[model samples]
Target chain A: MGEPLLVQSPGVPGSPVVTVAPGWAFAAVAVLGALVVVAAMLDGALSARSAGGPAGGAARPFGEVARLMRQRRRTTVQADSLLWRIGGAGLLVAAALMVAVVPLGRWTIFDLDVGVMWFNAMDVMVWALVWLTGWGANSAYSLVGGYRFLAHGLGYELPLMFALVAPAIAAQSLNVGKVAAAQEGLWFAVWMPVAFLVYLLGVAAFSVWGPFAPALGSDVAGGVRAELSGVDRLVFEAGRYALLAAGAAFSVPMFLGGGAGPVLPDWAWVLLKTLAVLWLLVWLRRRLPAFRPDMFLEVGWLVLLPAVLVQDLLVAVLAVWRT
Target chain B: MDMSPGGIPLAEGGEDRDGLQLDVLKVRLGPVLPHWPAGLVLHCALQGDVVTEVRAEVLDAGDEGRDDADALARALDNLVSVLALAGWEGAAAQARRIRDAALETGDRPEDLEGLERLRRRVRRSWTLRWSLRGLRPLTEEEVRHHGLPPDAVGDTYDRLIRMMDRAATGTRQDDRPVFRVEHLALLVIGLDLAAARLVLASLDVHELQADHTQHEVAHG
Candidate 1:
């Protein structure tokens, strides 16, 4: 029962993952892009269904890309162009960097020891990137949108950090592969449900997806993306979907028993699990309302923080007893 | 010190709600913004996203009175705005569909059924309820003071449900007074931009007319 789910390939002797060559990073990015596309397509279809349109909404993403690509780049008065571009482009990079530590099945690129913390750091980088995107626009609405994200960050970040601690505590190792390995028969999500739920909320929060999307609310005229136009808007939006996809991918190892399944190969299971999670996140967008930053701050601090902390405590006690 | 960068005047400093001196930037919330009243423009003095001061105006408010035929559709359209602002896209889209159907086909039974389903769904949404609850509650006196309709008596959430009810029943009460553009500036003061937008959307100001007279809301 404790045997490794997938056979480790030849590379590092003691490591749970084989460090694939640098060229494989492109393949990883392609997978991330595919997940992003699928999520976008699904969201488009759902939107159309709700709006009483035919199933033709799946093609909306492609149409939008073409339209944006051909459109002119918009610039604001006194806009800090460099920082804006960086913030716009940095989300995809952060998502890429996060997946660097995530082991696919038996193979992983850049098998860092503290992979969980690496993923955490990348998410924290989102705080800066989104705000920078907001600030660089030099528009009043965009700036307000940026501040709203920071307010949400203050609420979600702590609880998210503690949620990460649960798996690390139960596994007694910060390494994500090791953590996945520790969950031989039991997934962390099944036992520490509070942490799992908070982690999902955190993922949604950091991705600026669904309920945590007041930063891009319609009232603020697209909020952070208020002034973004042309290819710049396209890239910024792609980055958001990519972040959501990456978050779902990372959760496989952290919570859902990574690469652990029957009949199908390990990599296939990982992809399937990721697709399921990504679909859930995208579907959730239609179901919930936006969380008001001020009201959410209280819920984050009062409810989510305490609940996840208790989950971590329970996991900690169980880990110690097992040892 | 008068300095204009990129032809825009620099923001002036003012005491914020926290008693800290902060830069107050003048920003306009649209006559053309999405989900906003069609011709209303709110010129505001913002200190860190909070509306410290405001002035309201409306553009192109012609002599033509309200279109009584489209009142139900307009009510549904306002519901769409409130739902969309609340971040419930599915429900917003559902409301939009019903609204569009109402506009196209008038009082179809299918549209009415859809509206009923949407009303129940929105009411059942604890998340939506939680998000909209207790935001900008206007008492009866406050409503009268603002010259707003009696329907605007409750908080944003209550107003939202009442808006749904208004759409469902198609009851345009004669006692319900017209909402002028000037009242917007007064109502939105002291709230942050998002909440202010929510409050405005909840009012379902279908009969709003342009009042060219500029009225300044006192800075607290």
Candidate 2:
């Protein structure tokens, strides 16, 4: 809200953030791509270690990309090709949109007044995009996978929305930058641990990562992606990791102290924090089992929802008392 | 309506568990699936994701001779499927490593030690316990009626732990009844697709014998 800081020098900022021109979105996207690649490599290495194989597995993403790019497209008899392709490609686009408002140290692409709400909207789009991807395939397993995601969405979306509210209430602003700056002395994650944990769980849910991956469960023969192959499958898989990376990046402003580390530039701190969170999410995939939708529904509503709501109430009370 | 859209028949409307009319899609879960039984197939009439009706059969079932040396490895292989289906990739991969070592070296001392560690890991996982708890519990009467092994007497989580113990101690039950393919339909009737798959994997069905009469078993 204060001076846009369009041409402020790095490491000597007054407002701590500047609104960059839209042309720099490409650079933002490139950063997201790098994070995705790092996440995939970490996952591959972990998989290899678990299987007692050689470290050469870290190069698997490159091999997979090359193979999928070269392979022919697969189709079903009654496949809705149009909607299917949109669903497959929309995730990366949504992830790109999510990171647009997330300021990297002292710069952001689109520094909207309501950046937090923009992120929430982008995440909600995942519910539709994933379902469409499932519905477009025209396979029974794919349809089931699609419905499974919706079921998970039902349980997690409300809690996630509430979790987002906690930071906004404490910051007294919907702007993501303000939320990050509000934690001048202490990060919101420290005071609101429950909301932070729930936010992470929601990110995992939206990205279809780790325990929230029943929609892509192998029991249903890859579930929603059962029939996807070649370039289409490649894009869909890349989009998932991109979303995870983007979610981690956004957490910098909303939960972690955005670019608030010493001995490093703000942007460098942002990137380092993003990479650390990204690696943690990737590593967790092997540690937990899939949360079957039926059992998880009860837990989401009864445990997570109430717990996050309490965290929000306590945050609101503190904000009021401080004012 | 027998109309075929793009060479695929449209699903018909049917009553679901809640008495609401829903489209019933005839889906098949199979012999070719990643974690499914080798020769078993279930032609399911699904209302949404729930299996409204199911008919299971085994294809090309015969007495494939067993190797006594790799019995422990075979148990570990089944354990791998159960863990993978439960969506714990790390434990599944660890189980696979032990199974591969058992296969290659005939249960050497190191393999036994690995099995013990894997067993302890699986036992200690509370998340795994929570995910699999109370899923498709088989009572003693149900187990005896379906010709299930004595080890299948508990719920899915219990069966999982029992499987680990069996693999670790090398307790091969030689006189167990041949699990007929017909029993699969009865076991998975009212459950949804994911639960059905987990229940099937938890059954520890090592071998399935074909029902020569080709009888259809239907349930709602």
Candidate 3:
């Protein structure tokens, strides 16, 4: 529902591209999003409440997390304590900023010339910082986690990079806005369905928000996060959510045609589409079985990588025919 | 020494002298580490835990003026260590009462509260030792024991067991619940063998007489 907020009869006349004021739009959306998150927390609390006690659900986690924060932070294992402090904080900051860069509705830091490249930069930053954290811990599980991250990153990355580029080839501009706009009348899904499928698959693997959730698994070297505790654990969990937010952000423009709706404003349409995709990610986590790392790597290399490459060819053919 | 039939003279030659029969000794317990508060002085009489005859003393730690009463209290309390041979209960009580009277005579709340609490605690130790003849010492053979040095404590053990007997089984000589070795050691250290043995018999430790002889044989 991409409806106009304040429609002007002939306001510079190209799809009536109305501008939202600087900071005002962001200030409003942040307030609304925070309220939504609060509501979601309350909803989650009510569902988890038990019959025996006062039903401290949200309150319990909040108090527990707060208490852990206050508790003396001591690393029992002999490791560089300084690195644990630094890298853990550094990854949290990186992930938070990456989340901020994505469009919540139509408001983002910028929909830059290389908006798609922005996500890749953020993705690379996360893994690097994560590796630092895992290694700094100087633990067996942490080392295994760092290695698994590298392995999984290598496996999922090729397909994801192709999927990101496939849409760019279809739109013929590196800009996410233009690519999203190209899918306006007929979503690129019609012509490049395999590429769309591959992109979704790639986001799941690379974003750390899917059944490709290798690092958080209880088994398999515990996926790099088995050794984290207290604030370290908190920062990691927050980073995961931030990355999940980024994944939802990427999916909007790729499959759903970023902010393309009839009634709502462009940013609102962007928000609606992004939230829908994020909810699906949550649903998949709830419903689907986890993917084995080797099996996923096989699919990524043998299957998805080839599919996006073919979609890139098809999009090129379609562009040539249109010209 | 008037050797009365019971071995201890009842009234020092039966002279109910038409005058105050007061005896006093001052005992200073410490250059006590900071954990053990300084200025803990006890003044007591030679009577018993019941304080049948009494007067007491203490010294001010930081007094530059050197008030006569404070000096006398210190002198008395200092003399209390030598009086330990006389008795801790008497010397402690005499030193405590003297400190109490001197501190109470002062208007300071800080000095009074701390000094008085120390006084009460020392008296409680005497009273506790009094009650503990059959109560079992923390030392000795781990059964019946005593508190303080043998030269320091008095014959409070016999009085304590007798009090317990009168209260519990209605006879001081009743040998039902016997005391143990710890209790005996405490009584020995408290320097009152007669009272200590009485407490032992009350624990029914008469049963261990054979074991005692065997131990004596091994040690001897």
Candidate 4:
């Protein structure tokens, strides 16, 4: 028989909160970073293959990193180097902070009361982080790319926040661990399809990878990150993939019943689910086209917002009925 | 809004539809843009990311090549850039692969088959059509007067379809290049930078290389 899960605090009975050694937190971050790198490598190969170029192969992403590292740093005249550096590094920091709350099996660094809100706040931070990187460059194209990201942010943020509400409401707690625990019997995703769909959209938007990638769109010549070169480009690229990986990992707890699976350790289940979600998000890029900001705004406000609200309403009613 | 040292209006102050004062900033796209046609520059006066005034010009006259193989290679290059802008990396890569194979091996059967499959997939993509449909619709007069290739005489979608068809067939039939340098400035004037890029890509504005040579010939 497995030992009873250790509770961090004694105040609440039957709470899903668990405590782990401090070393595990660092190990989790390292593992997540590796997963992100793998996802990015796969993404590069996928993009290359799709474009009819030679497949990036196993070593292409690694080779790209080396090439970028050796390239000399290029700077614009009158550019705010300080702000630009901050903006470049901020993405990785934001991703790390967001991922900190995500549970790996029964362990998380901080199982806070408002993990859902924390995740939302970190994503919103990405909006500012991208704009700052663009504006800091003082180049017209980069600045415009920054503006595009903000426009995209306006379209996706509210609906994304609304989608987050469904899981929190069903669990009757804002804590992510509790939400995952609530799904032990039946996953919320099975019932809350609309919210799940909107959440996926939100994931794409925050990561700026697939259809929602207007900020870094090629139309603006690489958008907000257009001016980046050398180490700056490398760090930013890593940060982007990390953010994407974190988004997919967070989805596991919120909708996919977290670590709950048959015949596998909780950590293994979390890893498997995270990989599945990450693969899905990356695959979608080739399947969909980037949406025009104006079109996306209209859809976000008119369609996605209303649809997620109704999903939230239904979840609320169902929660009450079950109670 | 500020004036430059040369007495040029660096940032023009303007009023929006809501009567709010807007700061117009001058931004340049390309001559150095990624996934953009090489040696093309766009000067834009933007009022809150909307292009209120725009100008297009060629910075460098490209290498002149008119052979059938070069033409196909150039067409594939254009296809690559356009697909990149559309964010269709898979199809764009396929085009590149076929183009490379055609040039290196002289239209191998396998490469042609791959190109055919790619054409079907791109043509069948509703997402591609949704992204491209009705954008930069051309009047029959404009298309004819420009001497555009017969297949390229419609919207961006039509041009893309034509490009795909030629790519699949590995055709050697010379389609008259229909690019007028002045039309670029005209077409991009009111469009936002993103739409402007799509229009330029669809037109394969690089085909204006021929027009540039003609201009140089007249001047020389």
lDDT of 1 at A156: 99
Clashing residue pairs in candidate 1 (N, C-alpha, C atoms within 3 angstroms): none
* TM-score of each predicted structure versus truth: 0.94, 0.94, 0.50, 0.89
Off by over 4 Å in 3: A1-64, A76-78, A81-87, A90-92, A95-107, A220-223, B1-220
Residue-level lDDT of model 4, residues B1-220, one tens digit each, is: 3445335445558985457898778877778766567777778788766777777777766566576667677777777777777777667667778778768866533355576677778888887788788888888787777655555678998888877666555565444563555557777776667777877888766665566666676778
lDDT (10s digit) by residue, model 3, range B97-208 = 5445554574332333234443344345542343333332334323223322221222434333332223222122223232123333333233222122233333332223
Please write out the lDDT profile of model 3 over residues A249-284, one tens digit for every residue.
677776677777898877777777767766665444
Maximum-DockQ candidate: 2
- DockQ, in order, for the candidates? 0.79, 0.79, 0.00, 0.45
Q: Please report, as a value between 0 and 1, the fraction of native contacts recovered by candidate 2.
A: 0.90
Candidate 2, residues A1-323: lDDT per residue as tens digits? Answer: 23233653343234446877666888889999999999998888898888998878799899999999999999998899999999999999999999998999878887677789999999999999999999999999899999899999999999999999999999998888888999888998899999999999999999999999999988887888988999999999999999999999999889999989999988899999999888888998999988888788898999999999999999999999999
TM-score of chain B of each: 0.87, 0.89, 0.20, 0.81
DockQ-better candidate, 1 vs 3: 1
Q: Pairs clashing in candidate 4?
A: A50-B90, A51-B89, A51-B90, A51-B93, A51-B94, A52-B93, A52-B94
Q: Mark the regions of model 1 whose C-alpha exceeds 4 Å error after superposition.
A: A1-13, B63-69, B108-111, B178-180, B208-220
Chain A TM-score values for every predicted structure, listed in order? 0.96, 0.95, 0.78, 0.94
TM-score of 4: 0.89
lDDT tens readout by residue for model 4, A1-323: 24344547443346576755555667767977898788878887777666555665556788899999999999887788899889998988998888888887887777777899999999999988888899899777788888777888899999999999999999998888898989977888888989988988888887777777767877776778889999999999888888988988898899999999999998789889999989998888877767776567877999999999999999999999999
Clash count per candidate:
0, 0, 44, 7
Residue A272 of model 1 has an lDDT of 96
